[model samples]
Structure formats: structure tokens, C-alpha cells
Target: MEKRRVVITGMGTVNPLGHNTADSWQAVREGVCGIAPITQYDSSAQKVHLAAEVKDWDPTVYIDKREVRHMARYTQFAMASAKEAMADSGLDLSAENLERCAVIVSSGIGGISTTESEQTRCLQRGFDKASPFYIPTSIANMAAGQIAIAFGFKGMCTCPVTACAGGSNAVGDAFRHIRDGYADMALCGGAEAAVTPLSIGGFTSMRALHVGDDPSRASIPFDGERDGFVMGEGAGILLLEEYEHAVARGAKIYAEVVGYGATCDAYHITAPAPGGEGGARAMAQAIQDAGITADQVDYVNAHGTSTPLNDSGETAAIKTVFGDHAYKMAVSSTKSMTGHMLGAAGAVEAIFTALALKDGYLPATINYKTPDPACDLDYVPNEGRSADIHYALSNSLGFGGHNACVLLKKWEG
Candidate 1:
């Protein structure tokens, strides 16, 4: 059987940079850094002092107060972004078959804040002091569940908890569902709100977080002085529909979901494989799946997490996959501004890639002063620029050796 074509109709995001897609994209294009001193909790006693937190968020804007009380921060972010995406798509759920719609939102660590708070309450008082909504709100799958419930989507509703790659994996899975004719349309993305003391302390113990207090230099990916990643929290969602189905409804298309590739290094649990061998394979597989040569790809939204291993390794992977063209293509890591959104990073970067294709612009890697010898790509340093990009790739590499890539093409029609 022939596979169906898939196209993205809408996108939404609530991240450290902004609360909506328009604001976030504009901040990205302008190279605004969102990292700053940790404001969610007092970090005076903590070794890691900075993070990229959603600024001045009010859940009541998207969800009712009573309902918001029962939801975790991650779920709230997911629902808020999903609401924007659904509205942007102009998808009349009442007119379509509910069973034909799907939701695949994911999170790496869901409700860690809730768990920490409830655990403290239990220990300080009693186990029975825990809220009845504890189990429902803290699970990683709740984001996908809540989105489906709110939108009345009675289709496949699931979440991918593949660490940092969870969001990209969710988008890829949803794309396959539509392309394989199992679903007609879907909402997919990832969310993460693990900025609690416990989450930050754990990552700090592993030496995975940047210890710098300077907001501008906290997430300087591919820069020589970079030491570690800055934890970020938020959600990003995209509305995808079959091409013919979307055209029939006169929906505005953002980009074509042309290819998806997923791979595992099977080499390590925390660190990436040597030379980013697994990431190279994932990119090669995505290019092959798209039926395009490596040279046709114009831009790459790299998974440059600012860690020594990841940046150098991902650079090697790009060179391996694209050879000399890797130097010519515009490559940048928006993480330089938004920090690392953990599982949500992939989905958010995917949305940025789609916007880049639609708008013919390439975001920059901000605060990049000294380039690493190993990572010598263009990086679109310091400032964004206009480009006639036809194809763009978004990459997400995660712990446990997982790597996922999604390819997007300009929507000419």
C-alpha cells in the first residue's frame, strides 16, 4: 500500500522565551536569552544557580482555576499549547470523526514538582495527606491524556518518555500514524516542567547543568567556554493532517513532514556514542527516507546541548552525514537562547524548523564568542539571517542512546 502525505497546519508553544508561538519565534529570531537566576525556588544554596523558566505564567489564561488546581505544571503547559495549536489549525472537531484524530504529547520527567511537594507533605504529616489527584497529575502520560480529553479526541492517545528525544519521538510517531493511514490528523509534541529543587539537584549531581549565573553565557552551545546545559521548561505542539484532507478543509500549511528517523547507540546509558555514530545514522536514515541526497538539506537545528561531549560528537555526526556540505549549510542551536527544554526540546525545535522553512529565516546560536575547534559549522552566529531554505532538519539526542530526527520541507502550494 502507498503511504499518505503529511503536512503541518499549525504550531504552538509555551516556553521560557514566550507563552505563544509568535512571541517565542520572534524572540528566537532576535537571539534573546531566556536563562537567568533560578526564580522558581531559592537557589542560593544550590550549586546550579540558573535556569530557563517560563516567565510570569498564569494557568488561568488557558484553563479554569478549579481544573488548573488538579493539573501539574507540565500538563498545564501541554494543554495551553494544544489549545493554541488546535485553534490555529481551525480544525472543527465537531465536523470530523473523533476517532480519526490522535494525540501524542510526551514528557521526560512529568510532575516532579508535584511528586516532591506531595512527598514532603507525606513525610512531614502522613501518607494520607497526599492529594487524590497526585497519581493522575504526576504521570508522564497525563499530558497526552489531558489534551485528548479536553479536545474530545477519541483516537490513539499516548506519550513517549524517551528522555530528551521524547518530543521528537512523539511528533515522528504521530506523523507515521497519519502517513500509514491509521489516522487522518493528529496533535503531537512534548512538555517538561521539572524545574524543582530535586530535578535540578539530580542533574547537577550528574554534572549535566551549567553552573554559570550569567544569563547570556549560560547556554552557549558550540562555544569553547561552554561547560554544561541549562535546564529549561515548557511545551510545544504541532497540528498535522493528511495533505489531501488538509487541502479539502482549506487549512494553511506550514511545512511538509517528509521524513522521520530514530536510532539507538546501544553504546552508553548517559553519554553519547563516540563521534556521534548513532546520530549520524539517524540523520542519514532521515535523508534516505525523504528520498533526498544530503546536499539538498539546507539547514539543521542541531542538538547542541553545550556539553563538551554532545557538541563535539554532534558536529562529528553532521560532518559524517553531510561531508563537506556540513560546513556550507546553516547550522544553529536555539538552545543558546531557550536553554535545554529536556524532552520538550525536540518538539519545540521542530516547530522552529517549520517556521524557518515557512519564513525563509535561520535563527542564530547566540552568545557564541569562541568557537570550539571540533565544532566548526556555520552556527549562524550572533544574528539570524534570511535564506531560501527548502529543506530543514531538527535533531534530538537523548540519554540511553536514543536519537531522533525529523525532516521538514517548504510548503510551496
Candidate 2:
């Protein structure tokens, strides 16, 4: 059976650098660093005291005060991005084919702030001190559920919880749904707001966070002196529709979703398989699904999290998948500026890839001062480059050995 084609018509993001797509893309292309000292709370005791936090985000501007109070910060971020994406798409749910539109938003850790706050209240006051909205606010699927309710989407509404791969998985699943005729369009992506005390403590306990006091020096992916990933909080959402529907509606198409691949290491809960065998398989599968050779891919947005294992493992995966062509491809890690958004990483990086295709420009991996022998590739080091990208691949690797890859191509029509 011939599969339906899918294309991205609009995108939205709430990141540490900016709140909207244009501003975020501009900041990224300019190599803006979003990390800073933790200002939301007292981080004096935390080993990793800095994080990339979303600034000047007024949720009340998008949602009612009462509604915002009932939702978690992660949910608020997701809704804000989703609203922007829907508006950008110019697809009025009231006029569109509502039954054929769906929502798939994922999160790695949901509502950490709510969970921490309720726990504190329980300890400070009593068990009865917990807010009645605690359960609803803390669940991971509420982001997708609220989006469905907000937009009155009657099609599939689901969330994929594959740690950092959640965003890519959500988008991949949404694409398959449309391809398989389950839906005509989808509001898909991920949100994360886990930069909390418990999150920091957990990651620090595992020694997975960079403790560099200076924000600019942290999250230096592919840098020889890199320590670890800087925790970040934000959301990225994309409005995807079947290609024909998008064209028929005269939507502003950003890119075409051509392929998707996912795999598991089955080796460790937190580490990649030896030589990145799993990641290689995911990349290869995505290439195959796109019906293109590895050499045909113009760029790759890496899962480069600035961690020792990930950088080396991903480097090996690229070699295994692309062979000598890996050296020629324009690969980069936008995490160099946005820090690690965990579940939201894939969505934002996918946006970066789409923007690269749209604008014929590739954002750089900033602060690439030193070279690692293991990670030798054209990382677009420290500066943006103008390139006519034909096919862009975005990868996401996460805990539980999850790996996902999505291929986006320039919209030809």
C-alpha cells in the first residue's frame, strides 16, 4: 500500500533562549547560550547549580489564571507551544476536519515542581494538605490530554514516555498514524520542566550533570574538556498534516517528514550498547525508511548531550551507519546552546533541523574549542553555516536504551 505523505506546516517552541519559533531559531543560529545560575530556587547546596531555564514566560497570557494554577509548569509550557503551533498553522479546529486531527505530546518526567511542592506540603502540614489537583497536574499524559481538550481534537490522543526519546517517538508515532490513515493531522512534540531539586539531585548522584560554575563553558558538546550535560527546561511542538491536506489548505510548509526509526540497546538503563550498535541500527533504519542512501543525507542533528559515553558512542554510531560519509556530513549538537532538555530535546532539535532546511542554514555546536579524536566530524563548530540542506536527520537517545531517529526533507511541492 502506498503510504500518505506528511509535512510540517508550523512549529512552536518555549526554550531557555526564547518563547517563540522565530526568536528561538535566531538565538540558536547566533549561538546564544541559555544556561545560567539557578534562579527559581536556592541552589547553593546543589552540586550542579546552573541550568537553562525558560525566561519571561507568562503562562497567563495564553491561559486563564485559574487554568494555569491547575496545570503544572511542564503542562503550561506544552500548552503555550501548542497554541503557537496551532496559530501558526492557521488551522482552525472549528473549521478543519476535526475528527481526523490528533494530539501526541510526550514528557520524560512530568510535573516535578508539583510533585515536589505537594510532598513539601505533606511534610510541613499533613497528608490532607495536598492540593486536590495534584494528581491531575502531575500525570505525564495531561499535556496531550489538555491539548486535545483545548483544541477539541477527537482523533488519537496519546503520549510516548521514552525518556529523552519521547519527543521523537511522539512525532514518529504521529507520522505513522497519518501514514496509516488513522489521522489526517497531528499536533505532536514534547515538553519538559524537570529542572527541580529532585531532578538535579538524581542526575548529580549519577554524575550526569556539568558542575562548571560558568554557564558559557558548560554543555560544550564534542569539546575535549567537556564534563557533562546542563539540565534545561522547555517545550517544542510541531503542527503536522498530510501533505495533500497541507497543500490544499495553503499552509506554510516547513519540511517533509519522510522517515522514522527507533531501537533499544537492551544493555543498560542509562548507557548505550557497545560501539553504539543500537544507535547505528536506528540511523540505518531511518535511512532505509526514507529510501535513501546514507550519503544522501545532508545534515544530522546529533544527540550529543556533552556526556562522555554519549559523545563517543554516538560518534561510533555515526561511523557505523554512514561510514566515510559521516566525515563529510554537517553534523552538530544544538544542545551546545540549549543545554539538555531531556524529553523535549528531540522536538527542539527536530525544529532546528527543519529550520535548517527551510532557511538553508545550519546552526553550530557552540564552544567547540577542543577536538576529541573519537568524535571527529564536521560539527559546524562554533559558527552557523549557510548550506542548502536536502535531507536532515535528527537523533535522540535516552535512558532505558531508547534510540530514535527522524528524517526531514525540504518540501519539494
Error of 1 at 210 (Å): 0.8
Candidate 2 is scored at a TM of 0.99
- What are the TM-scores, per candidate, against the unseen true structure? 0.99, 0.99
Clashing pairs in 2: none
The residue pairs found clashing in candidate 1 are none
**Candidate 2 C-alpha RMSD relative to the actual structure:** 0.8
Any runs in candidate 1 off by more than 4 Å, and if so which? none
| lDDT of every predicted structure (CA atoms) | 0.95, 0.92
What is the C-alpha local distance difference test score of candidate 1?
Answer: 0.95
lDDT of 2 by residue, 35-124 (tens): 889888899987988999998779998889999998999999999999999899998667787889999998999898899989998999
- Residue-level lDDT of model 1, residues 184-275, one tens digit each, is 99999999998999999999999999897788888989999999999999999999999999999999999999999999999999999999
Off by over 4 Å in 2: none
